[model samples]
Target: MNGCRAKGSWVADEKDTVHYSGAAGGWGSVRGMTEVLARERPTPAALDTLRRQNKPGGFMCVSCAWGKPKHPHPFEFCENGAKATLWEMTSRRCTPEFFAQHTVTELRDWKDYDLEHQGRLTHPMRYDRATDKYVPCAWDEAFAAIGTELKRLDPKSTVFYASGRASLETSYLYALFARMYGHNNLPDSSNMCHETTSVALKKAIGSPVGTCVLEDLEKCDAIFFFGHNTGSNAPRLLHPLQEAVKRGVQIVTFNPIRETGLERFKNPQSPVEMLTGKETEISSLYLQVKAGGDIAAIMGMIKHVLSTEERRWREDKRHVLDVDFLAQHTTGFETVKAHAEQLSWEEIERESGLARADLEKAADVYIAAERTIFMYGMGLTQHVHGSDNLTTLVDLALLKGSIGREGAGISPIRGHSNVQGQRTVGISEKPELVPLDRMAEQFAFDPPRDTGLNTVDACEKIISGEVKAFIGLGGNFVRAIPEQVKMEQAWQSMRLTVQIATKLNRSHLINGEVAYLLPCLGRSERDMQVTGAQAVTMEDSLSCIHGSQGNGHPASDHLKSEVAIVCGMAKATLPPNPKARWDDWTADYGLIRDLIEESYPEMFADFNARVFTPGGFYKGNAARERIWKTESGKAEFTVPTSLSALGLGDKEGRWRLMTLRSNDQFNTTIYGYSDRLRGIEGTRDIVLMHPDDIAAAGLAEGQVVSLASDADDGEHRQVDGLTVTPYLLPRGCIGAYYPETNPLVPLWYHDEASKTPASKGVPVRIVT
Candidate 1:
């Protein structure tokens, strides 16, 4: 096992942590544009490709799931968007010759960044276990191999995994193909990132999505940002935040790590500000909440609002809790209010790691604002009580009657481009969301009726040799999950593993007894099918359904569209029937949408006409319309009301370790070695620690140490050589770059309800 600092990318000469984060956008963004393009895409034509990103008729950014505005500003793509578009539209290619030159073992030893940087996968390949290598295979041969594997296994034992990058049409067709092949084992990347956001919001709001659209950003009076680092992960969001700030909207940010993007942003889109070196302040009150303490922080705000409203009612007969909305549109308000009132200010301040005065000040702004929106990400959703964390946030939104109105609602900022859409289009393991009976009526196939394995459960089943076939549609699942050391071992035991991807990844390198890599066209690449160059539909974070048509040439002529790949595999696996019409749907994606409309008539009516419209149609959230679908047919208010649930109160020397994404990367993809805004110069090995904790742990700045998990999961989980440096973090808390720190996150350490990996708030002992 290698220490993080011992990796090829780490250099000891580099400083451990930067004192401050750079302004969100400016010359640094331009520098990122120049550097990433020069290294990967080196051509003037790349400029034209970047210009088309997120344009109504052009390709969507392959980075974040942030929605495109109805009236989008000029230069819709952000710094990371440019890099992602160019990275996908790169000139590099991973041809058959490259695989022939490197064995599976040899390529497995290469770094993740290097494997992806090698470029687009040019052809379908099957692993030759005898030769310890992969050889190019004909599309038919690959499809036949998959069919043979599917027939060999009990269809119930087979599992399907989807990444957020898959288009809505592709996702729908995939769901159909998997059911026709005889199982509903559809697990995906959403199981890892925002499952809590979906699961919790659904229970609370009757909608498994954000209640507001991009239009809300324009009119919101105040925004309470929770957990998500908008700058590095979804830079496009900063544009709207900047605009909101200009309109006098107050912003309050809550995160364990104080991201610079939330502090100040200079829109790279504004040339005047770019040249003048001016910046816009993003947060009016930035509270550095303790890792895993968001529940306490949010609960404290709820309590303050309740007390203020009660006091105000006593004084002037004017109320603040929107009692009228709560009485009519919600249930269980009394329970949540009682829970909020019970928590003492001392308990709130201690658990949240914030001064009582600071919490009250934030409450001041929140109470004063007529309309507010709450936006959060993994920081709040990747904890021991992650689902409860989201529940409390929803309760706050409901308490204020913030939801079901323009300029106010809950927005769980998604990590990937179409992850939400993937779930909506039936990529889940849930039996109800999958629309099983409706498919039988439409496609005339009896789909699996039982609930299937999710990502975490799928890993467990695979390890136990219960899962025979593992199929993936984008995403580095093998590495992204916790307990990678065991996951990779379990994955190798499967009878067959299949990857449908645009580029080479570590997951492809870890082959089963028989494995297949089916190269697919990326979002930026043209997918020429029997019909013509096709446009695919994707649902954004805001639930806006729009068309994404690629303008650039395919990375390689041999690459097939994801829909085509799914059809070929389906035709090979299932007995040929005139009724299925797999080929016809694959030939033209519009046919797939027509089927989707048939399945979800209320949501997708007039799908083709609406998806082509400029702004795309909102799928419409019932919660926003005050149309609740709970047991009582009303929105619910839930409060966990436990410090243990909030992950506070630990042993004296223990530190809460939070995994973070560098400004240079998105999710598992590494674009560069440094997080420039954070002042980190060249390495991802550094651990961000509060100065007080460094001294308390008998450690100094730049001291290399290992983090041993406090949880006794039978296995000792640890990440070595995590060089520590003083960072603007709460005391007893530390931050490490994600995926690198993923190993230390125990597989068993997950939210009980949502099963989301508790990547944040990992209790650890700093071993010097």
Candidate 2:
């Protein structure tokens, strides 16, 4: 491996000390950078004006959606959020002339960072094949062209795609437009991640979202964190963990490797800690479970808890099981107990890479806690049997009667701010019959009852030529999906590809037969609706709905709101109707709210009046109160029969591979090349491997290896030149960043229940 030298710094070799000349001078460098940024370009002072109570406006954070605000603070933005905000607020633009200077083919070769670092899009563009460049197009002309194209294809053949970054109103409008146009083909970013949580939660507890809120974190006596890296993925969460530690809360973490955030954290906010260079202890007990062994670990914990409770009940009159809650609010306990009893400690230890004593200790902590919260991330849901893993967690929560409580429940940390909102507004390609029927009646159009493709299915459809056009409502669609080569090819094969974005990305470079990049305003930019500057709503992980008003100037004067773009496309595609007036909604976002109010009256009641309040209302879930919506009106326990049943790592000697993003990144965007907390720098080629595994493979540290997956279908998938680094990870487990390793994941491989790609648990073998 070669190290690049910084400007004015001599290259160090052998024993010479390595230093970052660019990062030296600490706070002075940061202060100087801020000055440089300000001097480079003038920006709106409105952005500096903080919201009342010093909290960010409820618009979902453009970076990552980890949790919501319970208390206001002067500093709420995380590191990644700061990067996202700074990137959005940059005084740079990519005008039509910039596109005119470069062809799509030429732009395709540019790095992901260079493509987006060019800054925001300044105008709507349409590809001109004759000129081999994209030229500016009037909003009306673009809308009209989209309408003409919509009329040419069958509604089922056209897909309306959405990203998690979209606002609640925008997502609602996108879904309404699709239903009104007679198709339910809504493939979204959720399908690429966390779809398993939705599926498992709905089946086990009769709800799709997490039951715990941010406030609940403070109230919990203990928290069990699974398969998530708080340091990199959810940095803002570090404060809460720090606070919890200060309050004597016990945290038990389960992941393949010990994450820095979960080990020790220095709260930058604390003057004493900052001055003394002291760190807050995070995890009381850290268990390094093997990748794809989350279910086994969870099952082991439950098994221990049950046996201990039984033994105590026999000796003393103490019972760990909430018998009353179980008898009233749940069923199938007998079956669950029978299956759990059959799981031997040996098998559990072998599968989970955790000892019986470790699991017992964790269970003891859970049993002692009056209130506990179980939180997990993609690590628990990126396996072929991810839904089962989720079910197991739900079963544990139910066993302890954690739901409907103030301090305890199951919480799955969502990635995007509005991802939950998108799902709430019906972005799923597979809509329930009730929503479909309600939408059909409300829109005065018969929506197709047949199920539609998810992200994986959508890609397969495009590749097979079954899908014709693709319309994205705010995301890098090509980068988010699995199998990069196939995704790019499928995108190119589309008849028309429309991208509604605030900036340029690799997705825009992969053009269709007719491509259009429609510039849209960002969450931090002012959006002028017919009702004047308006606010958009976003639902946090805890189901608290909040409103956000952009304080910054629009990226471009020509950029439109996502709702406006959807209305424009709908007007062009659908027949003119009195009740479902797409043009009227486009004129003002308030009218869209009015329609939502009329449609989902139960949830969107007083949509206009309630949004003006300081903190938005909460969308109540009956399941959160232990009122199950299942067929039996109770939570159900599902028993996973065999490892093969999950269809992950079924092949011999095949280990499950999970792809994750570094702390410096959000989704497909790579702001920097280093993951500071992980001790990785300069490059993204390093893979996390167990020391024992490296020795077993006869590979020395830093050895380059090719990770490959055998395709039962006779095609080979491989990711080469991965620099292996021995870390404190569970044996038989490995970790690498995504998109770069996405090609190794087959489109056909996915969770059966949720249809989400198994990006977290791909089965592969290592070669040197």
Candidate 3:
């Protein structure tokens, strides 16, 4: 960790120069090149030993959604996964006495990195506003207080927020607790990122999950990756991409930025490549599309493919359409064909920011492949027309008869480890009729009929005084939500705020009138239940459900399992009723799984027995087999209009800013201070700009500038002193990390269809 420092500043090396320039506030800004060097170094042997996987053992890496290892790489973990692993296995601790000395106000000023770096919490803690400090409290006392506050407020006025990081068993218990309390305001992390995917998939295919599994990826002749950077976001997928490249699979990458992962990836596992310093070439063809332009690009490709099919039919009597499959499994071919024929290339190129030649080239790749896969990420969903973008991709997949094939289907790479699992086990605020009716029949209580508030709506309710309390299961609510000022104010206005967290964070700092921080066990920490030391289950991005057992001891003997804590609070809050059986469930996680099986029998059949498998089982996807689940029992096509009409306007000289994360960061959790692949060290605040745009803005390389959004409120949201880093991105486009540039996004700005905050495509004006 040694480096040169001058007046609290340090010089950066070649690799560190980029990261240091972009470093955000906190440890990233304070540390220099040394942090980058530390991250690149090989992982310690102790960590490798801890991550050992056997036929029956702990859960897989939660950091990325890349499926189980296809061919075992020497390093089982990716860089970001390693960071998450190390952070969870860190040797830091935060005791009750430490909280007693540090007041909530004092901790509020601390950076997010510094606060979390303080270490894991050992026991339950309740804030003492009288002394301006937190004091240790017995579990019973804390539960009683939580029960009292929950009882005081109407069920609808209380929000139960869950993060995707929580275990399936714990999430099930949480949902049960909320349902027993007679509210459905369960705003989990899925609502923020993949709600669009859920909504779009349900509308078009009748299923909310991806149709393709990890193994299916290897079978595709062509893969179209849109709006995702697999290298940094899901590094484990690099191995598959490397394999695909070696097999001569045509990979087409459609993104606004030329991501490093899509460009050239050096597989650390390949002996020759690693030894010779050779890199695997990925993305045979890379197309740079503008933000919010995904729909146009997809439609354009579909149009070109259809045209090619028509030409082939006229020349050789060969049809690209799978006539038998379409007749039996689909319904919207006529409408889709009509729209594709009518779409103008000019409109497509204008909206998608892709040239006509690029669209044709992509279509050529698609037409040549017998089977193809379409994969997308949040970049496709964080726009005003996110649903439209997703629908177009589905349209393309369906047109080529890709669905229900071996290596061909639509895949949405969800971020959180068990994000899909949480949604599966009923963490959704908007429960369909089937699950609700079943829940009522199983528990013998009429489930809440009215649709609940989403993440954004919940925050709005709190700010508008419609909600009086907030209870979070595992996420950093304040930091994750949009409109930080309003979110912070809402937390302060709450009558009670209860956070069941494994560590300290910004959410804990935003204290309520009656605030409590109940320290819980981390995922890497052992959970002791009545049965014995129990392992929690998590569903990976690919729908593989597996068990996770903590190798490390609990931060302290006082820390309780999240499931146990939820049961304790539920017992204290619910009216005297034997049906609740909160006590029996608290002693063992198996009991909770049994209840989940009772509620969702179709999805969780023999949950306990199935979880012991090595690779885990795949949750059934009807669309995977080309069984259309849409209203028409077919994959529907959506005709995309203008991006300008969507209200993502590019005024006179302004550029659209897409926020992304560095390799060192995972969501809001800053692991270290550098992004190695991006050649950035000790920095997260710099903005990536096209070299031409930088020059046009009268800004030189390494020069700092201020960026502001033209919101209606006239609020001066500026990120001052950001160095301009030149990149090969398209002109009138800029990139920066979220939470850092969150201020630039307007409170009301979000996808109209999904209500997800549009963190990706935001229009901003920069000044020198």
State candidate 3's TM-score. 0.92
TM-score, every prediction? 0.96, 0.93, 0.92
lDDT of every model, 2 decimals: 0.84, 0.77, 0.77
lDDT of 2 at 186: 90
A best-first ranking of the candidates according to their TM-score comes to 1, 2, 3
* Candidate 2 C-alpha error for residue 619, in Å: 0.7
Please tell me which predicted candidate would have the highest lDDT against the true structure: 1
Off by over 4 Å in 1: 1-17, 42-45, 644-649
**For candidate 2, lDDT tens digit of each residue in 1-768?**
343222334334211222222221123223432543453242553246223311545444676776556565566665556566666767888898899899888888887777887888999999987877889999999999988888898888888899888988889888888877878889888888898988989988888888887778879999999989887677778888788989999999998766767877776556676667577778999998877777788888889889988999999989898888888888888888888899898888877878989988988899899899999988888777888888888878888798878889999988887888888877877767237667667777777777877887788888889888889888888877777786786677788889999889988888888888999988877788776887787777777777777777887889898878888888888887777777667666777777777767887888887764444577788887788888777988777754222355546566667787865578888776655555556777767776677788787777788888754656577888888875556677678888778888888888888878888877778877
RMSD (CA, Å), each prediction = 3.3, 4.1, 4.6
User: Per-residue CA lDDT of candidate 1, range 675-755, in tens?
Assistant: 776777567877888767777778887788888877745687788877786777888888998888887777777887888
lDDT of 3 by residue, 1-768 (tens): 111111223233222222222211112222422343354332243254345531246546657666764344555666666567666655678888788779889998887778888877888888888988888889999999999989888999989999888889988878878988988899888888899898988888888888888787678899889988786788777778778888989999998876767777776555676566567778899988987788788888888988888898999999877767777776677787888788888888898889999999998998889989888899888887888888778878877688888988888998888888888888888867238887777777877877888898997888798988889998788888777866686678889999998778989888888988988877776678877888788887777787777766666899888888888999899887767777777777788788878887877899888876666777678888667777887776666554332445767767788888876677888766556555555566678887677778887777778778765466666666677886657678888876677767776788778888888888788877
User: What is candidate 1's local distance difference test score?
Assistant: 0.84
